[model samples]
Target: MEWWGVLEGLLLVLVLAALPLVLFALRRRWLARSGSLVECSLRISTRSSRSGTPGAGWALGVARYSGDELQWFRVFSLAFRPRLRVTRRGTTVLQTRPPEAAEVPMLYRDQRIVVLADSEGRQIDLAMETSSITGLLSWLEAAPPETRYPV
Candidate 1:
């Protein structure tokens, strides 16, 4: 094969590899601008066998408030629907804290992580800015009175 052919082959390989990444980024940007996505970390806590210590794994995702629900979509996923949804009716904010030294590196810049529990006792960790947290709290608090005590 000629030198130009080899270069062309390499170029094609690079483009094929990078195409998915470019598409993913474009999709995320579109979601952010159009859907008002808030960058966040979703914690996946695990239990260790030996010591039984809880370990946390954070996945970067974007969240948006849709009507009375908060929808979370993974940053790298191609799905159109959110992977997790939290409704305003029976959700409670358990705590809020700055990212730990270990978690800071995993979280986005200037994001605060908040722990929330649903009525079913399931815990979800959401990371966002202080302003976003305030907005979330407001949204949760603004749920209709009837929804708070469903018939």
Candidate 2:
């Protein structure tokens, strides 16, 4: 009888330890099913005024288009809100290039990276698959005609 109690206690501890991971998986699934999600690697540009070097490193996240804005949420996070949001009207693709060999291990295989500048002049790097690049370009170009003016 005492052994049974010990077994129950051990099981409870295991469940408690695994609860966060289970919740995170559920959140990720819900996000994916709720909208268009693109798997991407993101890094804040190193050219910011605060620092000459990049901050920390890349983060793996899912980018979802919510109306006219793109929301980025980290994959491993438990938070329900996006960490970054970029409006379509203010986003510009500054450049696109294949990942370097060192970066290849950090990103999805065969995915290309794009450098984008927002209206605030902040640079953001996004790495995604080739097909996703096409989708992203189409989304960026699909801004309402009234929102676009001659550069």
Candidate 3:
């Protein structure tokens, strides 16, 4: 093949390889942005609630899943253990119809934030209340060693 033609082919191959890398980076950026928005929504929900006890409130989260059956994940503190719950009816009627499998009691007061999502990873809704960021830190510090994850 002519020198110019060979160079042209090499250029084309390089462009094809770079194209995929560019597309992958764009997808990652998009997913990251969406995750950030979800996190922001959770933070805002708690920001407006009545942070009772002179800012003694803390932000804890509970996530409920929808579809054929009810499922949930509760995280009281980022540094502590996570509780998972699964039910047939749903979490909303926990009092009327208790969960089929009980893990840990999720306190309404501690749950400053609640989120609902589908299996596809789409967030359905979220709720948040002003949390004493300081209190959460203290609770996390005192949390059991087994509950914490080492960096």
Which candidate leads the pack in lDDT? 2
The residue-by-residue lDDT of candidate 2 on 45-76, one tens digit each, is 53544343333467888899889998899988
TM-scores of all predicted structures = 0.78, 0.88, 0.26
In angstroms, give how far residue 97 of model 1 lies from its true place. 2.3
Q: Report clashes for each candidate as comma-separated counts.
A: 0, 0, 4
Weakest ten-residue segment in model 2 by summed lDDT = 46-55
Ranking by lDDT: 2, 1, 3
After TM-score superposition, the amount by which residue 84's alpha carbon in candidate 1 deviates from its true location, in angstroms, is 1.2
Q: State each model's CA lDDT, in order.
A: 0.79, 0.83, 0.34
